[model samples]
Target: MKFAIISVTEQGHKLAKNLLEYLENDPSVIKVDVYHKNVNSTLNKCFEEYDCWVGIMASGIMVRSVCPLIKTKFTDPAVLVIGENGKHVISLLSGHMGGANHFAVKLAGMIGAVPVITTATDLAGKMGLDTLAYQYWLELDHRISIKNINQNIAAGGKVDLYLPTKFDFLKNHPIVNTSYKIDIWNKTFIQASFSGDEIVLTPRRMVAGVGSKKGVTEEQVFFALRSALQHLHLPLSRLDAIATADIKEDEEGIKLAAIKSDLPLMIKSLEEIRNFQHPDCTTSQLVKREFGVGGVSEPAALIEAGDNSRLILKKTAYNGVTVAVAVAI
Candidate 1:
């Protein structure tokens, strides 16, 4: 994952540099972009390009600068703020559920800073609702679901435990309320009151369709991908994988989108699409000739039939550039 660290002080710069080095050596962190002192000026440029942001400055400034971006809700990248002296590192937003809290704790340990983890369930060493949702690949409609679940759990209310199979954690946890006869597929958990020990179980699957123009940079591609997902009312994390034509092999945007999304880009060749025998399909000769590959045909062939899908967004021009989405069914 890519990261951007902003620090103003000389000491902060040194610390940021050291952190960059540490992240560079770690396999999980693919890149670290350090921006010291002039964070406000560079914020816009760096915001959409990275997976996480670490600000070594006053908490107030961190909050202010990040607030606008947060309001936009483009993507939930882990945002953290560390003290200038490395005394503390706090996850301001997108904590464990977004994988930010976990990243903060790891960074704190490496730098010998105090990880001021404030998430109640995490501090209590109990299962966090958001974390649980992440583990099960479930997407909550709102952040209030997490708050409500945590509040109920803290108050000692029993929560329903719904899983495909019984696990040792569920067996041992005191708050787990389980029923062997319950079938999760047919039951909806929307109106179920939280007893603090119960959790609804459900399967998850999503696809992210990415479109790119020739010479499209990674940053541009990311913006398009984010806009497309937002238009479709889908979260980036929910995307299971990306589908595109084989010709995008050299497209930087396509490559980076796959990496940042942590989803494999399944590229289909022309022959593969030609062999697909779907009667409702429409072939695009212009697209084939232009891209030297069939963009729509490949994505359609790769997706399962009868699955409801929509075209979330058409190509939106940005500074004379265009991008589009091709969601599948």
Candidate 2:
């Protein structure tokens, strides 16, 4: 995981620097960038660049900068604030719902600091749907549904699992309606709904692709993907991965578009593309010439494995730009 460490004071700067060194040596942390000036502004930039933030400053400024992001629904990153003196580490934002509490405890253990966990639901040792959503990167489309599910679980009902792997952590979880069998590959939303209290365990549906003509604007790509998903009756939250050719790897417009969508853009190499095979494929020559790659691996994967096979959304925007949406088959 990548983390941005922001600090504005001398003590904060030293602490941030130490934390950076510690995190750099930790395998769990892929990258850690330390900024010792302009805490709020730097934090905003970090929020744009990184998945999470670690603030080695007072709670007041941390709260001030984070409140607006959460209030505006502006893709807030997981936030953890630590005192300069190393007295306390608090998961102030996101908490259990956003994985902040879990991160805080891990970081605190690494730094020998006290983790100040304050989420009531977690303290009570009950199942937290929001936390589960964060773990799987699922967008909680219906908070009422979660509330109702949790209520049922709390009332001694069982919750079912549709995931491929068994989650032993959830075996004795206090808030599961019941445990039922669900095959991740073959189950439909309607079928899963009828299989007793159920939550689908497939990958998220926020992933999208943008095959653009030369010099296409980011807004155009975004609009095309959104329109395509809407046309297919698919929510953006179900996406799990975005795919494109290696040529678009450094395209700022394409990269930012994926980030804005909360989707990881996987740039496939030519060899990887050549490995794909599909009988009904239609874009062979176009994929090779435009993408500078051999096959449409992403579209093929989406088609063969997508949940809503009957509702594939494919569209070409301005010029030769194209976008495709499919659930895991």
Candidate 3:
């Protein structure tokens, strides 16, 4: 994830640079940029650009600067406040979904500072619903009463849990109320029949594996994808990713379609797909002759989704493209 460190004083600037060097060395941190001059202007202009913002200044200064910029917890970037002396790192805003609390603890460990996380769930030694959703990559409707649900969990209150059989792992989670029976949503979707008071987590586990001919347009790829999802009565929003073989990584059409559709383009190595064995996958002689693989779409989908994932929709040929869907276990 991208991070921006804002510093005001010369000491703060030095601290920010030190923090940036440490963050850059971490494998999980993708990019770290430090800004020392024009603090207010930089924060205003680049607030949305970075995934998280670390301010090496007074807590009041950082809070006032971000007050107007703060929107909702779901959309805003994680904000961390640190003193120039680097005595403490505080998760100031977007503590759950934006992962401010997680980053604060990590940064504190790197810099020998105290990590101050103020979220109730953290203090209660329980996982917040929003944090659980973010960690698991589960989709939550913005309209849901997430604040109340999180409050209930934080106060040692019970919240009913509903999940599919594949997500039974959540039953052992700290936030789950084991006393209540875990209601199962037998269908692919769990959002269709749930009350507002109950906490719901929608797992985005569908991967749409695609194979396309050379020089196909983005429209053609999108058409094939839409057709395949329609056959299964699933919406584009339900899809987690679009998978393809690494050999087709240079296919601009598939890449463009994934970008336009706001889906991740998951590319699997040809060797991985060749070795991936699935009984239900369709074997194509033409694919084997060309890419030395029995199939492209079906195997790619199952391989990228998970080991236990099964094909929800088999290979379906469309105009210049083949599509398959898999639900991750």
Best by lDDT: 3
lDDT of 2 by residue, 1-329 (tens): 56788887899889888888887765335457888778667755557566568888888988898765563222456788998998788988767445788789878987899999876555655555666655544444444455665454444444455543223323344443242232343342311232244444334444455566556667766666666555433445455666666665666666766777777787766555566544323355766776555444344334434444321344334344566544432
Question: Which ten residues in a row are the worst by lDDT in model 1?
Answer: 177-186
lDDT of 1 at 150: 67
In model 3, where do residues sit more than 4 Å from their true spots? 142-144, 175-185, 189-199, 205-329
What CA RMSD would you report for each candidate?
A: 12.5, 13.9, 13.3
Please provide, for model 1 over 84-197, each residue's C-alpha lDDT reduced to its tens digit, 9 standing for 90 to 100.
899888988877656677778888988998887777666655665666554434545555555677665555443454433312223444323321222232233322235333
Q: What value does the lDDT take at residue 103 in candidate 3?
A: 88
Tens-digit lDDT track of model 3 for 249-297: 9999999999988899999999999888876686899999999998888
Window of ten residues with lowest summed lDDT in model 3: 187-196
Q: Considering TM-score, where higher is better, how would the candidates rank from best to worst?
A: 3, 1, 2
The clash count for each model shown is 12, 20, 0
> How does model 2 score by TM-score?
0.53
List the candidate 2 regions with Cα displacement exceeding 4 Å: 71-74, 137-140, 147-201, 204-329
